[model samples]
Target: MESLANLECFVRSAETGSFSAAARLLALTPAAVSRNVAMLERNLGVRLFQRSTRKLSLTETGEHFLASIGGNLHALQAAIGAVTTERGEPAGVLRVSLSPSFGIGQILPLMPQWLARYPLIRPDWQFENRPVDLIAEGFDAAIGGGFALTPGVVSRTLAPAHLIAVASPAYLAGRPLPRQPEDLAGLDNIVLRASRTGRVRQTVLRNAAGLESAVQLNESMIFNDPVAMREAALLGLGVALLVVPDALPWLERGELVRLLPDWYVDLGVISLYYPSRTLMPAKTRAFIDFITEHFEREALARRFRAGPG
Candidate 1:
């Protein structure tokens, strides 16, 4: 039988599309990954990859080989997990990636409880506004909002993300409140542009008269950070479309007010995403369960229901 180490290297290289990338992910050298793949190919008596100066492509044999072993490999991983769970407490490094704002406002504050509960687990956390390549980056899990997930990762919703249009009371004080969405054309709008795709600035609004219209505003300020957008809106720079959780403190403090509350967009759901559970490390599984339980039992649930305390 081919060594499991060689099989693992081959599978990782195929999934990531490069020997160097697979090596980095596996904490092995490029030569080591290449040697393992070559060894596996020799053992199987078939070429696994078409090597080139520029790129790598799987051979027909390699494709069939992967299909044949994938299910068995997943089952083997699951069996290992079942054995480990039945034995004792989980232990290992749990690597996590999350969006900056949510990481700061939501997850970080609650981490102390998680740490206390799982003394055997150590966590390595990264925060960014961009999506993480979980397998490539060696992260066990990611917390994110917006954007469709890449294939090969599993995702579960943690909360519903509600985007609201908000501006400071001073900005709207004596001005005719945008009774209809079309009236926003005359208002200054703040745009959050985290991704290159830019932010959505159009909104649909219904007036008290039950008349509905679409409003598209020209942005007066474009910011990549949600916190900065909130500050600009507070300074009366313009109106902003903000996620409710991030805007809650300002709204409660009377620094900002929601506009067109009835008509707003639903950004992608907030989720806790991870690689397939079958290969998940014990520490990762524990962290996932902890986060899931904490959100349900803590202030997060209430905040989502009653609009940020």
Candidate 2:
């Protein structure tokens, strides 16, 4: 039988698509991980990975082998972790993906408290703009909006992605303050072009009364990023529809003012996604509980709702 270490090296390498990343996770040198995988393939008398300088891909046989053994390996790790965790706190490298703006502004602030409770657990977090595949990419969890519910992945909603119109006081100095959604048409509008679709994002404003109205945003400046739009608005460029989280700090600091506060657009829910496995890692479970508890206690979901203050 091949050694468990070799199998682990192969599996992690496949998931990360690189020996270096797997090495970081396993605390092994890249050369050692490569050697272990090579040894495993030689023992099996078949090629597993189509190795190259730029990328590594699995062959047909490798794919089948991974499917057969991946679950079993995870179960074995979970069993070991369960036994170990009985002696002390959950400890390991916890790999998680997060949206850049939200993670930095909201979640990162909670880390000090989290670390105080679980000092042994180490966090390896990546701030990304795009949705990540939790299982295939080997992420323990991901926090973002609009991620598709792929097979073997489950999500817990954190907040409604409510969008509200905002502009700097400088921008609104001369222009009339918008009393309603339609009043925004006369002002210069800074807009976001959808990064994935390459088209301008459309907004339909809705209020507490269940009434919806469309606003015609005259694009004076266009951006493919929310941060850029916020900055443009701060520079007195134009009115921009911004997600509540993105607008909250500026709104609180009085750097930007919310317009037509009674109205908002519900884009979707920001969610926390994780693999739907039978035996999840102890570290992951602890992290999830900690984050969800924090959200509830802080009433962040309700705070994220855009309404009259």
Candidate 3:
């Protein structure tokens, strides 16, 4: 029989394509992970991976082995998790991925309250802009919008990912506010270039009346990140399209004014994503419940909607 630790080391190393990355996730030294993997390989009597200074590639046998054992390992973990949950408090390193702007502005504020409820759980969160591979990257959960639904993962939508046009009050002063999407062409537009596509995004604004219009803007400034766009708009550089949560605070503070308030671009829903296991880790379940409860109690879905304002 193979040790579970050896199997874990092999699987994590394969997933991350590096021993150092596997070590980080397992909270073990790289040398320890390497030795465990070596032990597993010795037991199997086969070369599992082809190692190099720059990369690690799986052998054909290793690929077959990984595919065969992956689901079984997860099932075993689920069984263990079920027993562990029944015995004690929800506690562990809760690894999560979050979008930089939204996470800091909205979810970060709730951490103190959440920690009070589950003090045993240690938070390990990565603030990133791009969508992450939940299983491959060993993320327990991820909070963001525009993530593709991969196998074995499910999402719970927290709010609408609607983007509304905004401009600093200083920039809007003495300028005619946009009453329609087409009117935006006259203003200095701070636009986002899609990070994956490397192309400027075309804005199509829709109103409550189901009226939709393709917006033509001056495109005076371009950014690859929403956070940068928000900051540029705050500095009175130009009009920017921002998600409701990102712009809400500035709008409330009178620093930024919503342009074409009745119109917004719907990208998708901001969602909480986690692996769809038969029995989820207790820490992950607790964190998901905490966030969902907070969103429901605050009516954030309604507030994040940009249809009326």
Please, what is the TM-score per model? 0.69, 0.75, 0.77
**What is candidate 2's local distance difference test score?**
0.84
Better of 2 and 3 by lDDT: 3
lDDT of 1 by residue, 1-309 (tens): 454446777888888999999887766667767887887887778999999998988999889988887667756555444333344777666789988887898789877888787766677889888887665455778998653465446888877676677899889988877754666678998876756566554565443344556666787887888888888899988888777788888888988988765555555478898866435566778888988987888656456532322
Minimum summed lDDT over a 10-residue window in model 1 is located at 300-309
Report the Cα lDDT for candidate 3: 0.86
Query: Where does model 2 exceed 4 Å of error?
Result: 1-77, 80-87, 307-309
Of 1 and 2, the candidate ranking higher by TM-score: 2
Stretches > 4 Å off in candidate 1: 1-87, 198-213, 299-309
* Candidate 3, number of clashes: 0
Where does candidate 3 stray beyond 4 Å?
1-79, 83-87
User: Per TM-score, what order, best first?
Assistant: 3, 2, 1
Worst-scoring 10-residue span by lDDT in model 3: 78-87
Per-residue lDDT of model 2, residues 3-87, tens digit only: 4457888999999999999978876668767888998998999999999899999999999999998878876655644423456
- lDDT for each residue of candidate 3 in 149-222, tens digit (9 for 90 to 100): 76557999998999999999899889988877999999999998987899999889898998889877799999
Q: What is the C-alpha RMSD of each candidate to the true structure, in Å?
A: 8.1, 8.2, 7.9
Candidate 2 lands at a TM-score of: 0.75
